[model samples]
Target: MYQKKLVGVFGDPVDDNPSVVIEQVAFDYMKLPMEYLTIQVKKGDLQAAIEGLRAMNFTGINITMPHKIDVLQYLDYVADDAKIMGAVNTIYVKDGKLYGENTDGKGFMRNLRNGNVPTKGKNVVLLGAGGVARAISVELANAGVKHITVVNVIKEEGERLVELLNSKTSVEATFVFWDHKYSVPDKTDIVVNATPIGFVNKEEKPNIVYESIHPQMVVCDVIPNNMNTLFLEEAKKIGCKTFHGMQMLVNQGAIAFELWTGLEAPVQVMLEALAKVYGD
Candidate 1:
């Protein structure tokens, strides 16, 4: 019998991330001799964790929050997409060389497309300027989003991402200050919350003006833990189409699975696994 391939995800406190169950479902469905695990490795020990993966001949490992950007320091090389996003969420080793890539953006796009949500020539208002926002913006630009308005509380990070998007992709990118008066543009086709506010704090209000959301618009929140986030709930109440955060997590995990195995991802199976875990 062939030995099992070893793969895992690493984060500061990875116990709660759904990638653990999602990837394991994929492996079992394919009947592949693979073991997927969740490892809790804080930022301080990132280098050691990565080194240990290399030493143990790990097939690949996924990097999560806090470590996504910092883990880049220990990689042998990073893909261009990951470089543009300024983070790495997937890493694979070959010939003793560690290669890093970011599939978060691609996964988001896949999820959107799979759900019949359109991106090409669409005006997107992306909330937050963090890692996930960076990935989403770049991928949207590459996928031919007509224009993008990025809103964030931090001026520096928002402007920095806009600059990167403008310089690297053909999409027209602009930064908007996120404040109390902020409202989703009426012409906007998609609104995305890449921030963590709604999930962590249930009482936290939705970032965009709930009244401004239209029936034609699609609202997405990248908070995986709570699928029916306040943002999505308000969007639904306002007749706007909504997407759950778990879809992003599953799609990204599927992309990582494919990257590691070089086989088509069992997307539906992964989705079922996510629904089972999240109870949606």
Candidate 2:
């Protein structure tokens, strides 16, 4: 008899999470006797859920939403990069100790490469300065992007991210106050919306000057649930290349997949699984 291991993700509103499908499909394709679950962990209950993971011997987990930053405190040790990034999206159990790591930026880069999106020497503009934005901005800098512009409603948060990118990476980063209708610089090659604006409410979109976006720009949204957001819709109307959040989700899930099972994740199978879920 083969003993099955356990793995999953922790988030508050996990109803539409597709990572379980992505990982489970890969596990089945590889004939691995493991089970993947997406548990609904409410706000203020993260510590308890982490304790539960320890008690139940979960092989690993991916934390999302409001818990990513808070989960760091519960981990036994974290990767140095994660410490600098100030966030951890993946954790694996080793010798009953939980070790934290961040795969968000790397995963996003993989998504870009797999999608054939160009980033080298490209000026990028990020619409938010949260964990996802920070992760993507750092990787964009590492990829030798020419410059980065961080736009956020909060001055302090945006300034801190700009400072981090400028002082740490070799990328010239600047901050911009997100005016009611923020305009994308004409020279920007890549535009990313890494905010929660269209999250709980799919109908909502970020306040931006949609007309300012040029046709050659690559527009991206990290909102997993609403792949075709209003921003993307507007970008499409302008003949801009638009990218969905599912791509990032699949890539990031693949990273966690390998971390948890110590096997090369069947990315093709996971992509197909996601395609079916997304109905394409």
Candidate 3:
């Protein structure tokens, strides 16, 4: 019998609640001798946790919020996408080298395409200008998205993302104010909720009125805890196509699993895992 390799996600709040999708992928689908674990590490203790992983010969680790960018400094090498996004969501040890990669962008794009949500020549409104948002903007641009409008609570953060996208791709990117009382653009092809508005404990939701969303437009919220967020629920009521953050998590987790194991990811296994955990 092969020795079971160990992989898991690491973050402050994630220790006790590792992603169910990840666990399902490892235990049910991949069928590899691997056990998924979650490690909670506060900002100050991140370095110690990473060191401990290295010492314990962990095959790979997924870095989540509050640690994604901070973990980069300790990595041996970072992939271009992670460096550009200033975030590292996935890390793997191979041939005595630590490699970092950001699959959030690819994962988002995969979910969009899989759902038949148009992107090419579409005007996209991206909420939040943080790490995940940055990656999503880049991917949209690369996928031939016609234009992108970014909105964030902080004006400067949104502007920075716009500048980065403009410098990196020809896609027209702009920043807009997220007015709580205003309506979303009717011409917007897609609206992506990339903020932590619907995250666990952070129950604050986006202010966009669901009735303003048109059937021609698609709404995507990057919160995975619940398959149907208030954002998605409202979009559904408006007859608009919708996507949850679960797809992003699954695609990215699968990509990370492949990177670590060099085997095709058991997508069905991962999907079932996520469904069981999140009640999808």
lDDT by residue (tens digit), candidate 1, 191-244:
998888867677675556688889999988888877788788888988988888
Q: What is the C-alpha lDDT of each candidate?
A: 0.86, 0.87, 0.81
At residue 9, candidate 2 shows an lDDT of: 85
What is the descending TM-score order?
Answer: 1, 3, 2
In model 3, residue pairs whose N, Cα or C atoms come closer than 3 Å (at least 3 residues apart or on different chains), thus clashing, are 4-33
lDDT of 3 by residue, 21-124 (tens): 46545655545777877777789998898887777888988888889999999889998767877889889998777888989998888898888777789999
- Candidate 1 positional error at 169, Å: 2.3
Give the Å shift of residue 36 in candidate 3: 1.9
The digit string of per-residue lDDT tens for model 2 on 196-216 reads 887777788889888899999
Judge candidate 3 against the unseen true structure and give its global Cα lDDT, from 0 to 1.
Answer: 0.81
State which candidate has the highest TM-score: 1
